[model samples]
Target: MSELLLNHLAGRPQAGSGPGTALSDPVLGTELARVDATGLDLREGFAFVREQAGAALRAMTYAQRAALLASIVKVLQANRDRYFEISTANSGTVKNDTAIDVDGGIYTLGFYAKLGAGLGERRHLLDGEAVALARDGSFQSQHLLVPTRGVALFINAFNFPAWGLWEKAGPALLSGVPVIVKPATATAWLTQRMVMDVIDAGILPAGALSVVCGSSAGLLDALQPFDVVSFTGSADTAAILRSHPAIVRGATRINIEADSVNSALLLPGEAPGSDAFELLVKEAAREMTQKAGQKCTAIRRIFVPEALYGAAAEAISARLAKTTVGNPRNEGVRMGSLVSRAQLAAVREGLAMLQRHAQVLHEGAAHALVDADPAVACCVGPTLLGARDPDSTRAVHDVEVFGPVATLLPYRDAAHALALVRRGQGSLVCSVYGSDPAALGAAARELADSHGRVHVVAPEVAASHTGHGNVMPQSLHGGPGRAGGGEELGGARALNFYHRRAAVQAGAGVQSTLA
Candidate 1:
């Protein structure tokens, strides 16, 4: 990276500062540039999106779409290193973490590409016999997964900006739907870079993929009935969007995946000094520190057996103490800064609220790594707390310090642990660590009603475990209540979000008679 690029990555003043104002990189800076809401040209963009969707649907066979997506995979592979560099620079994600996002995102595109190709070999609903009607005869019906004559609007979150945007866009495009992408300003530059790459590849039609770099003012209001809106962000924001008049009144298709207070449970069989005990500690710490703990799937709560609370707390704290927090570009830095100063502040506020019912088990605030410069970056070390009362509102459940932070909550028994996990209302994911299959299954079933995804970790699966902080393309990625009562990504389920279904009924005997 050049010096100018480095400065841009650091979000430093590019030019001389004006009186009482700074010139931080508008691209990677925490604060977003204010867009002129009224001046946005949605009409042209909307028309172009519609045109491209139609053209892409008409011109390309499903095999052609698959070939285009395969080309995208090759393009991404060639630029993988560049994406890692840019993603780390823009979002403070470490190289390995960013690599996972790139790899996972590429795999998602590959999956959809295969799906598109499969659509070609399958028989279209219209392929069946078409009946001719007699004097008083009526025709029967058929079902087809045709593309809806509308657009897909994607509103992505700051964390995993590239992945969020591409995951939705890939599937929608494969299903022959044009997508209008609106990435959160915190990391829009990375998304923009990726989109530019896609456009250069010439895979998508002219208006099949359009981007809104800034605000999306009046965008939702202009949507039609068959239009689809998929959002990935906070539950609070999802609620507001869910209530939009265009969506509610027009019954517009909407899919949401919001941040949730996910948890990890350590069963009694995993006592200290045992392999299972050690595995639990490692899993929790990894979830709390990876991607600087910005992921919605990160383990925010740790549920431990009452008898082993002290030992579990000590093990977790010791591991967290070893985490190296600094600039991601620095060698030996295991954990990087939070995405932005504002996000760091939000984490701090959540910590303050959590302190009301929890005691600090480990304090990384006082410790500093040699390469870290807090004054010049948004950095916070990993922190662990032991909740005084697991059932308390201020304890393990309500608060979500969305950084390298986790709260250890003690449970008297398996039943109590399951009850405490439910106090969070709904979570995107939850994990249980133990070698006992029966015990793990019971707890999993107990919490299955409240969590969207659950993982059982043991000696057998620990090595290959993706941990609690990862969401895959094939899985449903949202939960109920506090986690946003909507889902995204379940094969055809995501594609269906962009369509409307209506039943046409007639006499079947009349159709046969006419034939």
Candidate 2:
């Protein structure tokens, strides 16, 4: 591998004043690059974004900003191949997995671009229909949504440097807010490359987009009152960010996507050999193996009918057995390594803790990884676990082992399943598979309060439904409670996060213009 030295984007590519840290290939354990942020002037960078980039972006109308997003889409598409290569090398993901990050990011940007165009030439947005204050309708009150005159600081996770950065950036840029991304140090290479490419294309104004790819020492300290911070990582880190003075004292806006023990439910009355049963098995296994099960939305606990507990466990384990783990470069490798040895160790540690309360249905430890050295390669196959009595198991409900690991639990009925599902405290998503529409709808409604999204899959919509863990641009993401009481990505609604709302009481003539 070539030795790469990544530079931060502060209006342009620049080196740090502190010593840099080396990055290594997760699968091969070889040094790949270095990112230095020891003495980065993040406060100065924020000033540049708020003044230079902010002014230029705000000068453009919604439609003009949409055009810029469209240009970014084209640039990403043109360089998609290079991005896939970087993701595979640095993140240790297969082609299909890499597409979820690279292609997903492009698609999200495109979605926002088209969405922005629909808003026309407006610099601000109207929340709803204007309300009449006077009985004669002469005075009116209208809610106006205007972009905050501040910057957006994105602290992305290791599992999705590509999509994580773009997903947040899409809405922020569309809302006329500038962004500075701080990718997870483990997988900063891909994020840096993409940011570099976009800036090089000159599609965005200087200071409109920036990236700091090393120690996030001064990043939080640089926040202003109007600035927004969106973070995706552990709940512990989210708590730390929430307690920071910028958010607590200054009342700065913040959104967090943290640890979630999401679930997949097989509603009662579905026979072991039935279509719904099979579909649930397929989806549960897929969620466990996709991205090596590093996704926050991935299924950690699976609930099924008490009668089919043993059968369900057997079927899911059989499917997981077919997943071949190895390097992404290999032709038939269905599953790839974790992002790094540190991640692998963390997953193993968490898994071990959960094992005390559950029995292993299928251990991936014995599964030999193909075309890679077991000593150096950070590879692990899919493992299916079973909790004979889920109500008695605390770790199965509270702990999240972020790897290709999942535990099957049994429930007596729909009510029982819902109770068990809620044991997660809160989650990003919960998928229910069944043939009964009314029952499925009821389940979804009940799950909605605790989950950010509830995917209901009947046989008719099975093939068309996006996977349980996939976060779509048109739907809501993030959840309440342990999943983080945050919200994002529901079409134009996402733009609200980057904007401030105010109710304007004005005359009929002034309100008519807003209407």
Candidate 3:
């Protein structure tokens, strides 16, 4: 990694006056960069965006704004190799996994650019037909979604440094709002680097994009009435953000995508040796191993029929044993290390709590790592545990280990499986696997009540269905209760966050000339 400065978009590189924080490569324990953003004042930063960047973005037609994003996509794609290399080193993800962060960001920008062109050249969006406010039709009202003059603040998670920024920035820019991104301190190197590249491209207007690398000391305090803040992290942090004075007083809009205990259920009646069984086991193991199970959408609970409990455990364990954990650059390393040693320790604590209600089915020995030293590198093997009494085990459904760890529980019948699924309270996603459409459909319908997405993998779609851990751009990436009850990346619906909706009531002739 190269030495880079945090881009404040304040005309020049931000002066490093604050305490310098070091960003490290988890796999090699090497320093990547020193980040500090102390000299910039949040109040002035936001004021500059409102008067400068926000003005430029809002003045442009929707088509012109969309074209800017399209140009950004070109710039990022032109330098994808560098971005992929950085992601692998900083995030400790394998080659295939790094693509999700680097390539996924480019794809999201492309999708939003095309979407903006389709939105036309209108300045304000009209919601449905104008309604007659008076009986004589002298007065009418039309709902409008207008761009907010305030800035959009993004507090991202550590797991996805690239995708997290682009996904939020795409909609905010299209909606005519400036953005100030504050990535998680532990993994802010990639995000800061990307922000610098965007600034250098000069595709978007000046002051349109900025990033704070180390501390967000006064950012939230500088928020105005029209501003919006989006956060992705733990549920505990979400609760604190929700209760902030700005959010509580309706001065700013807040959106959160918190961590949850997501589950994957194998419906009853599928034979132990059938394709459905194999597919279910493969999906569970893949989700557990992907990104070292650091994803928010990773499966934490696996529910299987009572008859197939032993078989499911054996199959998943066998697949997990084939995984090789080490440095991400090594070809033999199927899975890489955790983001840092601190994260690995947190996972260990969570696993200890979960073991009180379950027994280890597949324990990864510290000495079994390939091409790596477990003491120096932050690596955790694909560990599996089995909960014998599903109904009595509260921690199995409530606790989230947040690493390459998953607990398998046995369900007696259809009702038992549904109960286990609902015990997660609310989840981002849940998958159902079986040959019977009738049973899968029933289970999906019930699971949808608690989960934001219910993925049904039947025999016909088993070969083509996306796995349980993948979050698509077109689908809503959030859920009901514990998952934060927030929605993001659901196509054009995300634009609503960067806009302000209002009902414009006026006479027919006046309404036509309002804009």
Best by TM-score: 2
Return the clash pairs for model 2, or none. none
Output the lDDT of residue 268, model 3.
79
Each prediction's whole-model lDDT (CA):
0.73, 0.91, 0.86
Q: Estimate each model's TM-score.
A: 0.87, 0.98, 0.96
Q: Is candidate 1 or candidate 3 better by TM-score?
A: 3
Which whole-number lDDT from 0 to 100 does residue 278 have in model 3? 87
In candidate 2, residue 452 scores what lDDT?
97
Task: Let me know the TM-score candidate 3 reaches against the reference structure.
Answer: 0.96
When sorted by lDDT, best at the front, the candidate numbers are: 2, 3, 1
lDDT string, candidate 2, 1-515, tens digits: 34445554558677876567777788888888888876666778889899889888988999999999999999999999999988988999999999999999999999999999999989999999889999999998999999999999999999998999899999999999999999999999999988888888989999898888888888889999999999999999999999999999999999999989999999988998799999999999999999999998999999999899999999998899889999899999999999999998998898889888899999989688988999999898888888878888988889988899999999987898999999999999999999999999999999999999999988998789999999999999999999988888999889999999999999989888885
Q: Which ten contiguous residues of candidate 2 have the minimum total lDDT?
A: 1-10
The residue-by-residue lDDT of candidate 1 on 478-508, one tens digit each, is 7887887777776656666554444334577
lDDT, model 1, position 406? 87
